[model samples]
Target chain A: MRLSELSKRSGVSTATIKYYLREGLLPPGERITATQADYDEEHLRRLRLVRALVQVGRVPVATAREVLAAVEDESSDQLSRLGTAVGALPHGPTTTGDDAATERAGRTAEEVQRRLGWRIVPGNPAHRMLISSLATLIRLGYPCEVDHLLPYGRAAAGIAEHELALIGEFEAPTTQLEAAVALTVLYEPVLLALRRLAQAEEAGRRFGANRGAGADPAADAEGEG
Target chain B: MRLSELSKRSGVSTATIKYYLREGLLPPGERITATQADYDEEHLRRLRLVRALVQVGRVPVATAREVLAAVEDESSDQLSRLGTAVGALPHGPTTTGDDAATERAGRTAEEVQRRLGWRIVPGNPAHRMLISSLATLIRLGYPCEVDHLLPYGRAAAGIAEHELALIGEFEAPTTQLEAAVALTVLYEPVLLALRRLAQAEEAGRRFGANRGAGADPAADAEGEG
Candidate 1:
C-alpha cells in the first residue's frame, strides 16, 4: 500500500498524513524510491488510530504522539495506557488563578469522593473539573448540594460500569486502552444528548399541555415525532 | 459603569469586551458621547450571560448570538426559549454522507427512544451522535446493543431531571434560557469527568487486584487511594 491507499483506508487526507509523518505522530513508511514510500497494514491501522486521536478525540498532535507511544509500549498495562490517553484529552476548565474557588472546589470534591467512597487522586483533571463546576454553581447562587451530586455520581457510576465492560472485551491491552479512550471521548455527545432528550420527555410527561405551569405547548409539539 | 468597570465586575478583559461588542455578541452600552458609554446593571447581567455562553459553555460566537437573540426575542416562552438555546449547542460526530452508518444508527436510536418512550426528533444531533458512536463501535468490532444504551439512558434521565429542576428556578424566560444553556454546556465536562472517575473507581472495585487475570498490581494500588 502506498500513502494514497493509506489515506483512502484511514479516511485521512494524504496531506494530513504527511503532516502527521512530519510531526512524528505517524511512523515513516518504508522508502520505496526517491519520491515514493510503501505503507503496510500496520501503517493503515496506525493512521486510523492517529486520525481518531487527533480528529475525533481532538487531542493535540504532541499529546497524540505521547498517547500513541504509551499505547505501543508493551511494557505498560491497560489501565496505565488508559491514563495516558485520558491525560492526552483536551481539558475543559481549571481553577488555575482563582485560589478561593480552587480551595472551595477542592474541598467539595474531596467530600463528594468521601461520601461516594470513590478513591480518585487529589489533583486528577476530573477532580478539578468537578470542583470548578461546583464552585461556579455556588458563585451563580445555585450552590449544588450533596443531594445534587449524589444522583450524578450514582448515575455516572452505573453508566461507567456498563461502558467499561463493553471495552473490556478487547484481548489486547493496547486495543482495549485505545477503545476505552475512543469510546469515552466520542460517545460523550451521545450520553449528554440522550440525557437532555430524556429531560425533555420527562418534562413533557410532568408539565406538557398545561399539566404544569412552566410547560409550553410549543415544547410539547416539538418534542413529538 | 463604564466598559472598564464592566470588565472588573465580569472578570472579562476590556479588550475581550470590546471584541464582543464589535462582534455583536454583546449589546453596546448606552451611548453617552462619541467616545464614552454608560453601562447599567442590565448590561452587567447580559455581559455575565455572554461570558457564560462563550467562556464556560464553549458555544461559538455566532451560535451564542443566535441563542441570545432568541433570549431577547420576547415572543417565545421559557420552555420554547430553552429549546432554542439547546438547539444551538455544538454538535458531536454526525453522519453526513455515511448513509449506511446513519441508517444503522438511526434504527438503534429509534429503538432506544421507543424503548424509553423518548420524544426527541429523529435528526436531532444527539440522535446522530448516538448513531455515529454505535456505528463506530460496530466498525471497531465492539458492537453495542440496546442493553448498553438502556442503562445509560436511564441514568442520564435521572441526572437530567435534577439538573432541569435546578435551572427551572429562574422565573424570567431569558434568564431561564441563559441558565439552561450555561448549565448544559459548562457542566458537560463535570458530568464526563465524574463518569470517567466513577468508571476508574468501579474498575478498581471489580477488577483491580484479584478478580481478573489481567489485573495489574499498580492499578490496585492506584485504586486504593
Candidate 2:
C-alpha cells in the first residue's frame, strides 16, 4: 500500500499521515523509489490507531506518541503498560485552587475508595482529577459528600467491569491496550449523550404536560411514542 | 456589593467579571457613582453560574449568553424552557461524514429511544449527538447496537433522575434551571473521573498482582487499605 491507500483506508488525510511520519508518531514506510514509499497492513493499523488517538481522543501528539510507545513496549508488563498509557492520557479539569477544598476533596476521594473497597494506585492521575472536580464542586457550594457519590461509583464500577471484559477478549496485550484507549476515549460521548437524552426524558416525564406544576397542554398530545 | 466584592466572594477575578459584564453574560450593575456600581446577591449568583458555564463548562461566551437568557426567560413554560436551555447547551461531537453510517446511526438512535419508551423531542441536540457518536463508532467499525447501549442508558437515566430530583428541590424555576446548567456541566467531570478511577480499580482486580498474567509482585504489597 502507498501513502494514498493508507490515507484512504484509514480515513486520515495523506498530508496528516506524512505529518505523523515526520513527527515519528508513525514509522517511515519502506522507500520504494525517490518519491514513493510502500506501507504495509501494519502501517494501516498503526495509522488507524494514531488517528483514533490524535483525532478522536483529542490527545496531544506528544502524549499520543508516549501512549503509543507504552502500547508497543512489549518489554513492560501488561498492567504497568496499561497504567503508564492511561496515566499519560489527560482526564478531567486541571484547576488548582483553594488548598482547603483540595484537601477535603482528597479525603473524600479516599473515603469513597474505602467504601468501594478499591486499592489506591498511589499516583493515578484520575485521583487528582477526581479531587479537582470535587474541589470545584465544594467551592461552588455543591454537596460532594461520599453518600452523594456512592451510587455514581457503583455505576462507574459496573461500566468499567463491562469495558474491561471487552478489552480482555482482545487477547493480545497490545490489542487489549489499544482497545482500552479507544474504548475509554470513545465511549465517553456515548455515555454522556445518553445521560443528556435521559435528563430530557426524565425532565419531560416530570415537568411535561401530564405531570408537574409547569405542565403544558400541548405536551400531553405528544406522549411517549 | 460591587465588582470587587462579587469577584472576591465568587473567586472569579475582577477582570474576568468585567469581561462577563461587558459580554452581557452578566447583567450590568446599578450605576451608583463615578466608575462604581452596586451589585446584589442575584448578581453574585448569576456571576457564579456564568463562571461555571464559561470556565468549567468551556461554553463559548455566546452560547453562555443564550443559555443564561433561556434560564431567565420566565415567559416560557418550565418544560419548554428546560428543553431550550439544554438544547442550546452543546452536547457531543459534531462530526459529519459517511452518510450511510450516519443514517444507520440515526436509525439506531431511534431504536434505542423507542426501546427506552421515551418520546422523541424533534431536533433535540442530544439525539443528533447520540447519532453522531454512533455514526463515528460505525465508521470506526465498532458495534453500537442498542443492546450494547441499554445498560449505559439505564445508568444515565438513573443518574439524571437523581440529579433532576435534586434540581427540583429548588423552589424557583430560575433556580432550578441554573442548577440544571451547573450540574449538567460541572458533574460531567465527576462522572468521567469516577469512570476512569473505576477502570483503574477494575483493571487492578483483573490484572494486578493478586490476579492474572503479567501481574506485578510489587502490587501485592499495596493491598486495599
Candidate 3:
C-alpha cells in the first residue's frame, strides 16, 4: 500500500508517517518506483505500536526511539535489559544522580527484577523517561523513593495483567490482532480514567477534615514555643 | 521587632517577607519607627499560613492574593465565597478561553465546598494553583474529571483533619501546626510517589508480555483484515 493508504488505514496523518520514517521510528517501505513505495502488514503493525507508545503512553520522541530500539534488538539478553529498564524508574524515595540515589535505585530495581524473575531488556527508553521524570520532580523539591512506590506499581501491574488475561473473554476480537486493537483503543482510556478517579479520591481525603475543627490555641502555643 | 525579627521568628526569609508584604499576602505589622517595624504572633501565624498555601499547596501568587482576601473578609458570605474559591479549579474537558477556564474552575471549587460543607474562603492561591494544574493535565490529554477527583481531594483533606485531631502528635507549639508540617512535607511526596508507581505498574503490565517477540503473524492478520 502507498502512504495515503497507510494514513487512511492507521488514521494517522501522512506528515506524521513521514516524520516517523525520518526519525528512524518506522522502517522504510520497499521502493516500488521513483516516487512510490510499497508498505506491508509489518509497517501497519509498527505504526500501531508507535501510536501506542507515543499517543497513549505520552512518551517523547527521543525516548520513544530508544524504546523502539530495545523492542527491535535481537540479542539474547534483550528481555533482561528491558526488565531492568522498567525497574529503574523512580517510584518512592529513589534519588537521581547522587551516589546514594543511584545505589538505592539500583538496589530497588534489582529486587523487583528478582521478585518477578522476568527477562527484560535493561535501558528501555520508557524506564529512562520515567526515571527522568522522577528526577525532575525531585529537583523541583519533591522527595520520594522508588522502593516505597514499588508496592503500588506492583499492584497496578497485577491489575493490568488481569485485564489482559480477560481479553479473551470478549467476543469482538477472535484473533490476537483484533484483540490488540480492542485492547489499545478501548481499554487504555478506561484504565487511565479509572486511575485518575482513584487519585482524585485519595487527594480529597488528604486535605479535608473528618477529625473536626482547626488546631486548639493551647496546642498551637506549645508547638510554636 | 523589625522585619528581620519577624523573618527569624517565622523561619521565612527577609526577602520573602518583603515580597509577601508587597503582594499584600501579609497584613502590616506595627510601624514603631520610620525604619523599624514590630510584628507579633499574629504576623507569625499569617506567615505560616502563607507558606502553606504557596510552597506546599503550590498556589500561584495572584490566586493566593484572592484567597487571602477571602480569608480576611468578615461577612457572613465570606465562608461561602471562600469555599467557592478553594474548590474552584479548572477541571473537566478542555476550554479555549481564560474566562471559560476560570468559570469551570469555580464550579469545581463549589463542588468541593458542597461536598465537604466547609466554610472555605475563596481567593486561596493554593486552591487556584491546584485547579490550574488539573486543567493543564486535561489540556495535555489526560482524561480526568474534577468531580471524580473530588473524592481524592476530600480524602487528603480528611487525613489532614485527622492529623490535626491527634493531641500530643507533636511535642511543640501546637500539634495542629506540627501536623500541618508533617502533612505538607511528608504526605505530598508519599502520595505523588504512590501515583507514579501505579502508573509504572500499569505500563509494565501492558507492555511487559510478548515483548521482543516480533509482531505475531496471526495477530497482525486479524488486526488488518
- DockQ, all candidates in order: 0.37, 0.46, 0.08
User: Lowest summed lDDT over 10 consecutive residues: which window, candidate 2 chain B?
Assistant: B216-225
Error of 1 at A202 (Å): 3.4
Instruction: Report how far residue B101 has shifted in candidate 2, in Å.
Output: 1.9
TM, chain A, every candidate: 0.84, 0.88, 0.52
Give the proportion of true interface contacts each model preserves, from 0 to 1: 0.54, 0.60, 0.05
If you superpose only chain B onto the true chain B, what TM-score does each candidate give? 0.85, 0.89, 0.49
List pairs with backbone clashes in candidate 2: none
* lDDT per residue as tens, model 1, B133-163: 6676554334467767899888987887887
DockQ of 3: 0.08
Query: Which portions of model 3 show Cα errors greater than 4 Å?
Result: A9-11, A40-59, A76-225, B1-13, B25-32, B36-60, B63-192, B195-225
lDDT of 1 by residue, A1-225 (tens): 998888876667899999999999888999999999999976776776776677667888888888888777778665666766676676667664465656666777776776776775866677777887777665544446766687888888888888878877867766777667777766676787787777666656543556466645345334444
The top-ranked prediction according to DockQ is 2
Candidate 2: residue B146 lDDT (0-100)? 80
Would you give me the overall lDDT of model 3? Answer: 0.48
1 or 2, greater by lDDT: 2
Comparison by TM-score, 2 against 3, better one: 2
How many Å off is the CA of B180 in candidate 1? 1.3
A115, model 3: CA deviation in Å? 15
Sort by DockQ, best first: what order? 2, 1, 3
Better of 2 and 3 by lDDT: 2
